[model samples]
Target chain A: MSVLVVLEQRGGKWNRTSFEALAAGQKIGQALATPVTAAVLGSNIDSLATEAAAFDIQKVFAIDDAALEQYTPDGYAAALEQLIQASTPKVVVFPHTYQVRDYAPKLATRFRKSLVSDVVDLKTVSGGLSYVRQLFQGKLNADIPAEGDLQFVSIQAGAFRAAEPASATNPIEQFRVKLDPSAIRSKPEAPYREAQRSVDLGAAPVIVSVGRGIKEKENLPVVEALANALGAELAASRPICDNGWLPMERQVGSSGQTVSPKVYFAVGISGAIQHLVGMKGSKTVVAINKDENAPIFETADYGIVGDLFEVVPALVEEIQKTKA
Target chain B: MKIIVSVKQVPARDSSLRVDAQGKWLEEADLTYEMNEPDAYALEEALQLKEKLGGEVVVLCAGPQRAAQTIREALAKGADRAIHIEWEERAAPDALTTAQLLANAVKPESPDFILTGLQSDDLGYGQTGVVLAELLGFAHATIVMEVEPQGDAVRVKRELEDGWFQHVSLPLPVVLTIQSGIKKLRYATLMGIKKAKTKEVKTIPASQLGIDLNSGLVMERIYLPTRSKKTQIFSGEPKQAAHQLVEKLKFEARVI
Candidate 1:
């Protein structure tokens, strides 16, 4: 039995998480004692195929087709279905990306299987494989065992470190898929940014992010004052931006910007996995919330269980004094 | 512009969850429930589309009797009617099984559009809509932010990662999983709530759907996530805690 890792690329550039999926695939391959084969699909992906071949894998399949030049669930799923049928790999892995989410389920369903998505960890128990994923917004963890022979799994971003390329050069094979134009139902236009991102939160040294715990739009300045005192950019969770209190660009989470500031101050945020995945890379995390059980503290280096209204103002005052 | 919006009832966002004795699902005795957040947005989008294009909006939900409350909320907000597929099992089905059940109920309607939440709050399979589309031979899109009905098709804006957006046009009879917070939700008026009680709610047992219930994925166990980091908690008065935090940021973190 062999493992196939499907890598995602847009405009010839790989999604960084592709390597993470590769890393997870490598580990899984080792556990199962199977060879790992990587696949990249696009019109002209020879370079991508060669790049993937540099990794310590058995071989790379460059599934090239003109229909795949643009991503539609139909084209990608149909092509991958053909590849899977021909290769007959025991396992299929993806990076749990937006594009993968769009098509992987349908592809798995074609094989009479379900995709175990956003898997963060896996282990072999009694010679059977089991995958671990977050549930209830990361409050709980569930262990799901593989049921069928051909298991479909999508690795969560950051769950596994990206695999580095080795000196070994594997074989690159070109697999052409025959896709009919009429079968591609959805017509995809060019992807575009919504607006000129006014705030470059990624470059910010420090960010004071607010969440549902902040109460109301009127209460925003309580945290804004803290951001001002610390000379940090003001950011918020999805709900705050959804309420129009903050612009969509200022939102930081899975749907918004992913930031890795020098310091991240999470004020009244409960640290749902959605928000946690975005900011977990921050060098230093400080959480201030009334609920001591808030999941944000799990990722935080330092935490204070106090009302933000009381703690934030005092902290702002203390910071101003310290800076003075 | 006939539209079918699939929704699920989940524990209220603020309800603290507790694992049941079986360690397979949440304890349901004391939990309050509401319409799943993203599904609520899908219902809202369906209602808006019906209002503009003038067609029926049908609510399709699969859950226990408690799910009727959420169905009524959708009818109160503006769905023309609802189809309730009663699933009585305490253990939720996998995404494929759930989609098969939904597809069985949805096949008779032949709706121009089928909208579902991007993912459920509980299982979070995030694939029922796509799987349903595959089952019913309909085109599908996920993380849809906007939908506009064109002549015989629809134009939709889908959210990509990192603030990017892609516009796609799909022919009618498509399934679209809506993103959360795409549009503001509408509350039920007192009159609408009263009217909702009189509206038609067709109930069908999940077992009668004639679909296989066997799931491809099984949950072995469920438990609270173990804390990976030992967070340093500062316990004291708010002012003193703030002072301590400031000092730590300067000396320990060195960010400010």
Candidate 2:
């Protein structure tokens, strides 16, 4: 039996999360005693498949098709369904990217299987494999067991680190699938970024991020003052940017920019999984939230369980004094 | 055009969630429930589209008897009618199973458009709409930020990762999972609430769908997230804690 890891590619560029999925599949495949094969689907995915073959995969399938040049739920689902039916793999692993989110469920349903999606981690249990997924935002995690013979899994981004293959000499195989034009329903225009220039949070040395605890738009200036005192760039969680309190570029999370500043000051942020994953790599994490049990404290190197309104002003004064 | 919007009742985002006695699910007794955040956006999109394009907005939800409250809320918010798929199964149903139940309920309606939230705030599988589309043989898109109808086809702006967006065109009978924060959510007026009482709610039993309830992933157990870093809490007055934080940031962490 073999496991299939679907490699994501767009415009001849490989999505980095594809490597993360391959890394995860290799680990789980080893436990289940199954070989892992990486499959790349697109018109010109030869280079993408070749790059994937450098991983620890047993084989790479270059599933080239004109219909796959642009992703449509109908097209990708129909194509992958045929591939799965032909080569019955025990499990199929994918990176939980937006592209997969578009078509993965349709693919899973075609095979009459469950799509255990946005899984954070997986482990081999007594008799079967169990995937871990967060519930109630990030407060709880559930270990889900696979039930059917053929299982589909979508691993969340950054859940697993990408590791190199044992050697860079894996074999690559080319496969073609016939797709019906009539079956492909959605016509896509060229994808474009709305913002002409996005602020690169990754290059920032220090970032002061705010979360839901900031309460109102007026309170943002309190954290803004703290950010100014520390001489750090201002950032925020999804809610702040969503509320138009901050520019979209200033948001740090799975949907926002991933930042690894030398110092990350999280004000009133409860550290939801999405927000945490974006800033978890910060060298020094200092959290200021009123709730003692907020998840942000769990990840913070230094945490103050008090009202940010009071703490932020004091912290700002102290920082200015030290600078003086 | 007839549009169907799938809405779900979930624990309010700010609710203090606690694990159940079985350690398998959340205890709903003390938790407050409301329309899922993203699904509310989806309902708003459907209502706006109906108002502009002249169609009936039908809200569909699958839950226990308590879900009727959610359906009624959707009706008050401008849905013309509703279809409630009462799920009596005790086992936690997976995304595919839930989609099947919805597909069975939706097939008879043969609506030209379908909309659902990007995901529920609770389970957050984010796959129900796509799965439902597949089961019903409808073209689908996800993370939809904008929906514009163009004659026989519809154009949608879909949100991608890293602030990128893609515009796509799908023919009639399309499904879209709406992303949150797309537009301002509207409140149900007093008149709308009264009108909702007169709207039709077609209730169907989950057992009547002839679909296997236990056919997918099963939750083995659930527990609180394990903390990787042992956080040292700074107590006392706010000023003292702030002073201590600055000292630690400078002397211990050395980031400043």
The estimated TM-scores of all candidates read: 0.97, 0.96
| Candidate 1 chain A lDDT trough over 10 residues, lowest sum | A133-142
Docking class of 1: medium
Best by DockQ: 1
Worst 10 residues of 1 chain B by lDDT: B210-219
**Model 2: CAPRI class:** medium
Model 2 TM-score is 0.96
DockQ of each: 0.79, 0.76
Give lDDT tens digits, candidate 2, residues A169-253.
Answer: 6888777788998878889999898756467889999999998888899878999998888879999998788778898889898
Report the TM-score of candidate 1, chain B only: 0.96
The Cα error of candidate 1 at residue A277, in Å, is 3.3
Stretches off by above 4 angstroms in model 2 are B89-91
Question: Which candidate's TM-score is highest?
Answer: 1
TM-score of 1: 0.97
